[model samples]
Target: MDLTTYAILLAGALAGGFVSGLSGFGTAVMALGIWLYILPPAIAVPLVLICSVSSQISTLPSMWKVLDFKLAGPFVAGGLVGMPIGALLVARADPQNFKLSVGVMLLVFPTALYFIRKPMAFRFGGRPADAAIGFAGGILGGLAGLSGPLPTLWASIRGWTKDQRRGVFQIFNGSVLGAALILQIASGFVKWDVFWLAMLALPGTLIGARLGMRTYHALNDRNFYDVVLALLFLSGIGLVWSSIAPR
Candidate 1:
């Protein structure tokens, strides 16, 4: 990669890592956007996988105490089953259709958040609901790397505490994303030329996670939720625009 490309990758990694550290997601969206400008979407996806795994592993330790392991299993199981299918679809999908779909999702997600009432406590509707949400997350993750929002929506409906929600979601993402990365690697989506880029971004990921934990402690529950919603909306729009105007 040229110096300009290296700069873009580094900047994207730092920004994405910081956001994810604070919110438990968005690293892939951020990195993918920058990389898409310099690489094919197929290559961008695996590169994103590498970056996400690095970021999540760094963040997982501090948040480990807050993770809801019981709820994570079903979600992981469903994601493992569904992600490959989504990947297959992405491999064959028209780029224009992908942009349109992302645009629609961007417009819909924030509005959906506004209507949902937060529950008083954590409510797992049983294994069925868990499995269903997991499956939904996996499919979306595979197709667009946008799976975090679905589970976040479910968690919001159940009224999980901010730490609990973030921790659980990270665990869920780590499991599903780890598997997806393996598939992506096998398909040769990850390029050797970018391996160093992924490694170089690791420090940013670590810094971001630490900052995020601090931010999580500083914000009240309501403010934290609001911030997450806003990030989701903005990132969705950014992804849609990137796919459409990819420069």
Candidate 2:
């Protein structure tokens, strides 16, 4: 790759890594825009899975104390069920309208999140609601590399503690994205060149994640929630920009 493409690759990795590290998800929103400019969707999409999973792995130790498999189980099960369906629908969907609609929600929802005087914990719907949300996230992830928002939004609404929210989405995103990566590999998406690109991404991903974790640890639960909402807002902007930009 040329120096410019190489630069863009690492920049995307680092940016996405930082967000994923801090928020437990969002690699696609942060990285795919720039990555798409340099690499085809075939390469860019799988590379996102690789770097995102890598970033999640590097930050796992911090999350272990808060992570609970029982809490994340239903979501994962729902995601697995939805994953293949997403793969089937990707080609048939109207990409622009779909993204624009999601982008608008991303923009609108975060504004509501910002207005909450305190973390408003809702108690209704529980596990079944979570599974349905996870199913939606899985479809979005598999379709557009956009999975974290729904779960993250739900967690916040559940009035979870910061770490609780973090742990659920981290485990949820990692499991779903990891499974997606495996599907990609089995489908022959990981060619030697893509592997090489991922290798180059490793250092930047780790560094960005490390830095993000440091910031993560520095914040109180409330500050972290605000940061996540801010990131979501920016992600909305990115989505809107990409949907309208030249492919």
Candidate 3:
């Protein structure tokens, strides 16, 4: 990639990493938005995965204490089962239609969260429900390179403490991202070019994540949610617009 492309990718990584560090989600949305404009979706997805996983690792040390392994475990298991299917769908499916579907889903998320005030707990009714959510998350993860929002929403409804929510989300994302990278490699979606780009973005990712963590500590819960909601809404609109506009 040229200097301009590299610059763009680095900027996106910084922005996405910061968001992920603060909110435990939004890295993919932030990075993918710019990356897709520069690279094919297939390559963009994997590249974003690489950066995201790296950021998660950086934040893992601090988040370990609050990590909800029990809740994360089942969701990850389901993601593993679902990702391969999503990969296949992405490979064969029409890009436009898939974008439209993803856009609709993105739009629906904030709306549902807005209206649904009843908070639920994270404890699954059973293994089946846990597995089901994982499967769904994995499928979406593989296809759109975004699977955290669904599980994050689920966790939020459960009234998880902020730290617990962050820990659960980071673990879930890290696992799915690892699996998705492997599948993408096997499927030939991951290329040397993309790998290089991800490597180039690593420094920025680390810096951004640390900065975000600092910022997160400074913000109150209400302020944090306000920021996250605004970002999510804006990112959703961007995705929807990119889906409809002529390529």
Candidate 4:
């Protein structure tokens, strides 16, 4: 690729990494939209997965203590089941329409969550329900390389504490994206250009993640939630615009 493409990919990686570092999610929501402007979905999806895993692993040392199996286990099980189905769709679907639908849902659901005066105080689902959400997340991951939004929203609705939410976000994203990356590799979607771009993008990812983590540490729960809502809103806008943008 050209210098311009390299610059854009690195810049997108920085933004996406920072967001993932802060919230333990949104790597795809943040990066894929920007990358899509220059790359096809076929290349963009694998690149998103690769960079997302990179951003997520950078936070493990700090986040490992907060992970809760009871919360993440069933969801993971569901996600594992849903991923193959999503991957299959990747080969034979109208990606723009599918993404547009997801984009609309992302906009509507989070907006409603933000407006409610009295947010619920307790976790909202049983293991089965969590698994179902995970499965849906997996399908999205498979189809569009976006797995974080559904789980992130579910965690918000459940009213989890910051640590609880972060733990889920990181663990869930890592698991699903890692699985998708493996599938992508097996399918030969990862090309030399993807590898070289990832290498170039790495330093920016490290810097952005550190900065984001610092910001995350400074925020109170309310402020953190507000940030998440804003990020989700931006993610929705990005998705919608990408879906409708001229090719």
Best by lDDT: 4
Ranked by TM-score, the better of candidates 1 and 2 is 2
Candidate closer to the true structure by TM-score (higher is better), 2 or 4: 4
Ten-residue stretch with the least lDDT total in model 2: 87-96
Q: Model 4 over residues 205-234: C-alpha lDDT tens digits?
A: 777777888898898888888889889888
Tell me the spans in candidate 3 whose CA falls farther than 4 Å from its real position: 115-127
Pairs that collide, model 4: none
Q: What's the TM for model 1?
A: 0.87
TM-scores across all candidates? 0.87, 0.93, 0.88, 0.94
Order the candidates by TM-score, highest first: 4, 2, 3, 1
- Where does the lowest 10-residue lDDT sum fall in candidate 1? 114-123
Q: Encode model 3's per-residue lDDT on 1-247: one tens digit a residue.
A: 6888888888888988898888777788777766666778867778878888888888888788888888678888888889889878877877666666766776787676766555455565665776687788888788867877677656656666677667767888888877887888887878898887777888888899998888877877556655665666666776777778777
Alpha carbon deviation, residue 212, candidate 1 (Å): 2.3
Stretches of model 4 off by over 4 angstroms after superposition: 122-125
Give Cα-based local distance difference scores for all models: 0.73, 0.83, 0.76, 0.83
Q: What is the C-alpha lDDT profile of model 2 across 91-158, one tens digit per residue? A: 57676677678778889998898998675889788899889989998987776667788888887788
Question: Which has the greatest TM-score?
Answer: 4
Residue 5 lDDT (model 4)? 84
- Which candidate would rank higher by lDDT, 3 or 4? 4
